[model samples]
Target: MTCAFILGAAVWPGGRPSPTLERRSLHAAQMYHAGRVSRIMCCGGLGRNAPSEADVMVEILTGAGVPRTAILIEDRSTTTRENIAFGLERLGMSDEIVLVTDGYHAPRARAIARSLGIRCTSDSPAHKARPRTILRESGAWLKFLWQRMRGI
Candidate 1:
């Protein structure tokens, strides 16, 4: 019973899932419907002036025909590290996990999980995003690489 881990993005002020989040959530839902995974784990935390990202993702997945019981939310991780760490713990460090996120974010997401000693597979929906998203993710990659260089 592999669980699909849907990494959350920002939520709009009105609690809408951000584009990245919606994309990932939809992908997770599709995987569930296709019998690729047994459950979906939505991961994210609250941001300023917005609801928890995980909550938004759970809502989106549920609305996309995924049953509520099939979705689990970890709404307390504001950063990728927190998300991976807390999610791994909540899921009992299961080896059967498929990390879902945008392409640009998958490397770092997978690295973080591996750093924590959790082995799992990954799946990123086709990458199409605003220029801002590309830039932000690029910076994230640099930061992750720099931290690794520094052994942080």
Candidate 2:
């Protein structure tokens, strides 16, 4: 089976998904409707909020018309590496994977997945990165490289 891993983003206060999170989830739903993937795995943990990112994704996805059975949740990861690691660990490496995220984030996500020995393709939502977002991603790249060097 093919599964699209929808990486989590911030969940606003009061259990709302951030715009980025909603976009990612909706993109995954589109993938499902287009027959690109048979399953959707929502990956994320609690982030300064009540409901976890995975739970919010479930709500959005189901609201988007995806069946409950076709969705999987991994709500233990708080970072990109953990999102890929814990999610794949729970889902197993058997199914083909399609990593879903914003374009600016896809490279790091794909790199992390490859380091874990999973070969996968990726599809990203149309996102216009603000200057702040670009700066944040640059920092993330530095952190990822540092962790890789230390074998963390």
Candidate 3:
């Protein structure tokens, strides 16, 4: 099964970028650079206050040597839920999907993909905020649980 799917990286405000974001970039770059994915499907949309995350990732990947056309952008996803729902259709049976994000997002991301019938593994970048990130990711998990509770 050559179905390899790696999630796109992240960007920050001012597009100043984050260490976590760079780790996301490195994960994608390594996958692409290693020839794990023939074409990459970058997923993410603009955050409420930030520019399009997919666009930022695309710029970095292309600059790092992934061909422009080889990178596909799923630029409509505003949340990790959308990342799965929209990303699955965009990818369409990625033999293997490595959900890339900071350490904490792993659980829900896999669950979301499975809900959409997209089986996946993960590729979490080493966290810059390992301790704080755990808390943040924990908070994210709570938010996800709350979203499910609210049925959003």
Candidate 4:
């Protein structure tokens, strides 16, 4: 089975999904509708928002016509590494996975998955990265590299 792992993004103050989060969930829904993936796993925890990122993702996926039974929730991950690690542990060692997130975030997420011994592909929504987003992602890349170098 192929699973689309939808990584969490920011949730707005009113419990709404940020545009990036919505796009990621929608892309995963499309993958399911297109038969590219048989299931989806939403990965995230509560941030500054009331409902967790995974909860908002589930709302988006279901609203996009994907059934609840076709989705799995990993609602305790607050970072990319935890997202992949926790989700993979829940999924076991069988199904192939496709990481779904913003383009700027995909590389780090993929690398994290690889470091965990997971060979997976990735897909991202078409999003123009704002300068702030790019800068933030750069910092994230540095942190990821630092963690890898330290074997953390």
Candidate 5:
């Protein structure tokens, strides 16, 4: 069964889902309902706030009408690479999967998943990102490419 892995984003201090996270989790729910994936794995570790990003994602997915039984949480990862590594381990299967994140972030996430020998696809909610987010993701993508070039 294909699993959709929702990458982490910030959570409000009061455990509210950040806009990016909400979009990704909602997309995950839509994908699930459409039968694109059999399960959803929410991936992220705790931020400065109490609840982990995965926790916020789970709440959002369930609130969006995804069954709790179909959701899994990997709350031990803080970065995209860690998210893929730890999330794949938690899943315990190399079956087909999808990585859900912002458009700019998907390349790095996909590269990391591919490096781990995962058969994966990426999906974004197709929202325009803020200038700051684009800039940050650009730098991240460059780093990913450099690492790959260096065979790291």
Candidate 6:
């Protein structure tokens, strides 16, 4: 990865962190404080017309002791590509970012982000999600693949 960006998303059906997503945020925070990246660009938009994912993740991070100033929220994105693109333009982060999401999602997220000329890597943070949730994520991953292939 050239740099780092913490991808945020809506809470899972179960709730905040959703186990797996928590792992992603924790990893992103660790990466940020470990001197691996200069900034943490939180990505995601509002789902269900609720508070934005970026907002939700930032609160979680802050509760974990990450300062507000250290987080950047990209609130207009509704998809992986939109996440990277909106984040890059809105936050003006570095060329490279370590994409954060469920393990099943990292590959496709990185693929889409890099396709947009952004240097990116993967950090799967689904430590909190249960096996069933993971299976759901995997299904979503396949759907993502189909949509990308179909130019959707």
lDDT of each: 0.85, 0.93, 0.69, 0.94, 0.90, 0.70
Model 3 regions more than 4 Å off = 1-10, 48-50, 146-152
Q: Specify the highest-TM-score model's number.
A: 4
Query: Which scores greater on TM-score, model 2 or model 3?
Result: 2
* C-alpha lDDT of residue 19 in model 6: 50
Per-residue lDDT of model 1, residues 1-152, tens digit only = 89998887888878877778888999999999999999888999998647799888878888899999988888889888888788877888644989998887888889888887778788988876689878988898888889888988
Candidate 2 lDDT over 1-152, as tens digits, reads 99999998999988989999999999999999999999999999999996999999999999999999999999999998889888888899799999999999999889988888888888999999999989999999999899899997
TM-score of each: 0.91, 0.97, 0.80, 0.98, 0.92, 0.75
State the lDDT at 82 in candidate 5: 87
Off by over 4 Å in 2: none
lDDT tens digits, residue span 1-152, model 3: 33333444456668744565556765777777787766666777776546677777777778788888777778888777787677777866735667777667778788777666677787766665567668877887888778777866
TM-score of predicted structure 2: 0.97
Candidates ranked, most accurate by lDDT first: 4, 2, 5, 1, 6, 3
Highest lDDT among the candidates is held by which one?
4
Q: Candidates ranked by TM-score, best first? A: 4, 2, 5, 1, 3, 6
Task: State how far residue 76 of model 1 sits from its true place (Å).
Answer: 0.7
Clashes of 6: 8
lDDT per residue as tens, model 4, 95-128? 9999999988999899999999999999998999
Q: How far is each candidate from the true structure, as Cα RMSD in Å?
A: 1.6, 0.8, 2.7, 0.7, 1.5, 3.3
Q: Tens-digit lDDT track for model 5 on 1-152? A: 89999999998888888889899999999999999999999999998886999999988888989999999999999889888888889888856789999888888788888877776899998788799998998898888889889988
Model 5 weakest lDDT span, ten residues long: 111-120
The true-versus-predicted C-alpha distance at residue 30 of model 3, in Å, is 1.0
